[model samples]
Target: MGWIGETVDSIKSLQIRQVLTQTVSLGMIVTSALIIWKALMCITGSESPVVVVLSGSMEPGFKRGDILFLHMSTDPIRAGEIVVFNVDGREIPIVHRVIKVHERQDTGEVDVLTKGDNNYGDDRLLYAQGQLWLQRHHIMGRAVGFLPYVGWVTIIMTEKPIIKYILIGALGLLVVTSKE
Candidate 1:
């Protein structure tokens, strides 16, 4: 009876220790993710250093579910360079190639016209009413690199909220109940 009581107490203590260990590990994982995201933002000088392609407009070069790495540079934008920009009333940013660049001599401000690689006409029709060109302020970043198809996970999570919640719950359970 004495030996059994001692063993039960030890098992309870071990369970508590395991739960504490797993909690710390989970905190570390979340902290590391935030640190890495902030580091990328700093290095690229863009609020969003990465973006998922949602449209096939830039097809052949970048398909839907592709991830594009973005970089903001002080250098002037020119025709033929791919860029991401936000429209005046739209919530989503657009990725397209610069078709024309008009630089002001007095202020050095640039006005840009962009067109999707797969589209027939330029993006003027897509812009806000009466807006002819994208200004420097509207530009977010230039495409620096890409990873194909990895963004599908993000799209899936967004499209199916239930699956996302299930995955999160599973991860939490695994972390808490993990042996090592």
Candidate 2:
């Protein structure tokens, strides 16, 4: 009877130890991911260091479902360069090429005109009402690097909410059931 009681107590202790260990390991993984993202933001000097191409606007050069790496530099924005920018009252960002650059004589500030590679005309129609050009503040960053077709995963998950839910559930189950 004493031997049986000792065996049960040891089993319970080992189970508790395993649970605590897994919990701590999971916490560390989440924290590490966040640290890496924040570090990228700082290194790139952009709020979002990574962006997914959603449309074929810049097709032939940048296709839909491609992943773009962005960087914000102190150097002036120039024409013929691809840039991502946000328009007033708009939530989604636009990716296009700078077609023209207008420099001010009084304030020395610059305004940029952008157009998609495949589009018929400039982006002035897409801009906010009464806005003709994109200011520096509206620009997020310029494309520095890219990975082809890598952004499809994010696009699918965004377009299909059910798949995202299932994937999240599976990952949660995997973590809970992992023995190692």
Candidate 3:
């Protein structure tokens, strides 16, 4: 009986150590992800180097759940180029294609008008009140690349908090139970 009790105590101690190791490993994984995101931001010169498309307004070119890679550069924005921009009062950024570009001769500032491929009209109604065009400051980045449907995970995690928590719990459990 005494030997059995000692063995049980050792098992409990080993389980605790395994849990702690797994927790640290999970922390390291999250930290590495953050580091990679920051590196992409720096390299692309965009505040958001990657964004998940949340709307179908740009369908046929970009669809919902697509992951867009953005790049900010000094090159002039031209007509037909896709861009992401934030509205004055809107929290979500919008992705659309430039339909018109009006360059100011006096200040060299460019004013751009955008339209969604699936929409019949331009994006004037989406803009802020009394605003007609999107200035350079309003633009965040231009779409450089995209991965189709890859962002569905992000959308699912965002829309279903319980599923996200369950996934995290399951991953932690797997790590804690996994034997070397």
Candidate 4:
């Protein structure tokens, strides 16, 4: 009876140690991801250094489900350059081509007009009410590089949240069950 009780206590301690190890491992992984994201933000000088294209507005150049790498630089913006911007009332950001740029001589600020490649008209209608042009502050970053069709995973997860939850659960299960 005494030996059996000793065995039970040893087993409980081993289980607790395994759970703690898994929890620490999960924390380390999350911390590493955050560090990498902060490093990218510092390197690119953009709040969002990577964005997934969610629309087909810029078809033939940037299709849906594409992954775009953004870079915010000090160079002057020019016509025909692709940019991602946010509107005053809208939550999602838009990606479009710069059709026109009007630099004000008095303030040195520029009024930027943008249009989607597949759209018939400029983006004035899409802008906030009473606003005709996008300012420098509205611009998030310019498209520097892209990966074709790489953003489909993100799109699928966003469109179907169930899959996202299932994926997270599976990862947690694996981490907890992993022997090594």
Using TM-score as the measure, the top candidate is: 1
lDDT of 2 at 119: 97
- Ranking of predictions according to TM-score: 1, 2, 4, 3
Model 1 alpha-carbon drift over 4 Å, by segment = 1-14
TM-score for every candidate vs. truth? 0.91, 0.90, 0.88, 0.89
Q: Taking the tens digit of each residue's C-alpha lDDT, what string does model 1 give over 76-133?
A: 9999999999999999999999999999999999999999999999999999999999
lDDT of 3: 0.94
Worst 10 residues of 4 by lDDT: 8-17
lDDT of 2 by residue, 66-165 (tens): 9999999988899999999999999999999999999888987889999999999999899999899899999999999989999999999999999999
Question: In candidate 4, how many Å is residue 64 off?
Answer: 1.0
Q: CA lDDT, every prediction?
A: 0.95, 0.92, 0.94, 0.92
> Least accurate stretch of 10 residues (summed lDDT) in model 2?
8-17
Q: Please identify which of the two predictions, 1 or 4, would achieve the higher TM-score against the true structure.
A: 1
**Which tens-of-lDDT digit does each residue in 1-180 have in candidate 3?**
999999778668786667678788878998999999999999999999999999999998888999999999999999999999999999999999999999988998999999999999999999999999999999999999999999999999999999999999998777766765
Look at candidate 2 and tell me the lDDT of residue 92.
95
RMSD of each: 4.5, 5.0, 3.7, 4.3
Model 3: runs farther than 4 Å from truth? 1-11, 15-20
